[model samples]
Target: MIFRLSPKSRRNLSRIIPYGVIWLFLGWFILTLEFLATGNENQRPETEITLSFGVLVFASLAVFIAGLLMGVLEVFVFKNLFRSKGLGAKIALKMGIYLLFMLILNALTFPLAASLELGTTLTDEKVWEKFWRYLGSVTFWSTLISLSFHILLSLIYSGFSDHLGHGVLLNLFTGRYHRPLGESRIFMFLDMQSSTSLAEKLGHQRYFDFLSSYYNELSDAIVEHEGSVYQYIGDEIVITWETEKGLRNGQCVACFFAMRKQLESKARYFQEVYGVIPAFRAGLHCGQVTTGEIGALKKEIFFTGDVLNVTSRIQKLCKIYGKELITTQVLKDQLPQAMADQAQSLGDLELEGRAEKIELFSLA
Candidate 1:
């Protein structure tokens, strides 16, 4: 109850607020701008682009709550329902839904806004005329604003989708990788344990569905930890981050624990749906790699170096060590001192295909 949000509700509440703030600013700014540009100041000075303390506060809050509700419904309920429908239809549906939300929100909030002016938004004319005028203006603006915002935003997201990770889109456009750049990065290679058995048990289509559902659940943890998903190779996912960002606060290790916790929390759901709970073995490593754009038909950012190879080899050692999480000495040494107790040194070992041996640790 620290923020008056119950422990059970804290995570959901935290996710909603970030999206809520975006919606709040968009709604309030648009409404106020409309009033400033077209509202009749002489008729109602109090409500015409006037930012009274009570009106601004309550109006923004009402719209903000509506935004939060939209975010919750979109993420937890309606997101998956938006399937392979084409871009145009998706954009239309989103704008239409948001416009409906705005209409209802404005209906409730207008009264509060008028109260600040000691006046009503209604005209002293026939009831039907005032109603039609109010409804028309609200609906018109909501439609116009939502259509522009959602469609434009949809286009931007589509552009980003063509590239991997969040910032790759910008990197491509800016020619950031015209020359191969060497970067020190931390990588965590996660592979499903006994994936072959699980695939055979679930069958082809059902197996595909299982991975889809499992990855969807893990996505939240991935984003929360700021881990960039480098690629997905079948049941394996490679996550990478800059050395400083990944090692800072031991985020790279914490991400693994968070993902495990997330899946464990959903253990019952998986069992009921697929009759199996998925498990993963991860290997973490750090090294320098060259990054550059590759491929003509399909543009892509590729990372190449011995680091990837060594990381995969370490993941293979997980079966021998009987450990869920394994890390190279290089990565573990960079970790914060607080995490020292959690890592048990397995001593230096020769990883196959490489001449030299390196220290390895199993993270408990």
Candidate 2:
């Protein structure tokens, strides 16, 4: 009987077919050797070999079909069912469960096949005796080992071959796929000011080298502050932390400033390498954003909303106000008394496309 298969199922079957053929050939070769050594030359050698080959082929086909069915069930039915857990955990769990299922199937088939009888005593004994005995003995152990090996190999291959495919599948099946659900938050955009002008003065190769070191220093600092890097635009780095984390504790913001200080020392190395030192300007603002994967083929987590736009505008305002860092009143309101004293108020300034002028401040 023909069963309709999904595209995914067809793909999985295609992968299984080649492996099944190889195992079938191996099983036939091993069983053929046993038949030749045991069966007498006067007792019709061809008939004995054919019977042995049929049993081996049937057993091999049974194992292959069981694995193929389990793989199909996993890809189609189970994958969407568990879609709440993390990807890695889900795949590991599914593989474990699949292995257990195959073991159970083998257990059931062994006894049932052994109990079945053919017409005469010789035919009955010959059909059930060695067939079930072999399956219960070496075949069972071999199948277990081979399956374990396949799982390990598949995981290793998936890590390098298609990590995202595996990741997406895992997330989808385990129900672990979550879009960022946090409140409207503060975002900081830090840029190396006049970077283009500096790059032009320095040669292309030297400028590229300086940028590499510069980005490393910035990334290290952002990570230290527990900020997620949104993206790097030219020589600028955009980083974000939960507003509550940064404004309430102030640790995140403080760590970022400390990172800036560390970069200042690193700037000396850039000066030696490219004959120019880099300066950075930053801006911070608080607002709501939707953060999730965007793009069909090349997916990436991106934050989108007015909050992101305003943060960029505030960074540009750093050049207008002649300050290293700029922050909005929203950020100031959330700051502690002592930290607030360090900020220089820039009063209200009209920003492009805004209905009202915004109150801004600079970090001293």
C-alpha RMSD of each candidate structure in angstroms? 6.1, 15.8
Error of 1 at 149 (Å): 8.5
> Candidate 1, residues 21-70: lDDT per residue as tens digits?
66677767776676688662334332232456666687678767866776
On a 0 to 1 TM-score scale, where does candidate 2 land against the true structure?
0.54
- Candidate 2: list runs displaced more than 4 Å: 1-182
lDDT of 2 at 18: 38
Clashing pairs in 1: none
- Per-model TM-score versus the true fold: 0.67, 0.54
For all candidates in order, the CA lDDT equals 0.74, 0.65
Residue-by-residue lDDT tens digits, candidate 2, 245-335: 6675575567568767887887778777776767788888887887655567865555778888888898899898789888888887778
**Candidate maximizing TM-score:** 1
Query: Alpha-carbon error at 37 in model 1, in Å?
Result: 20
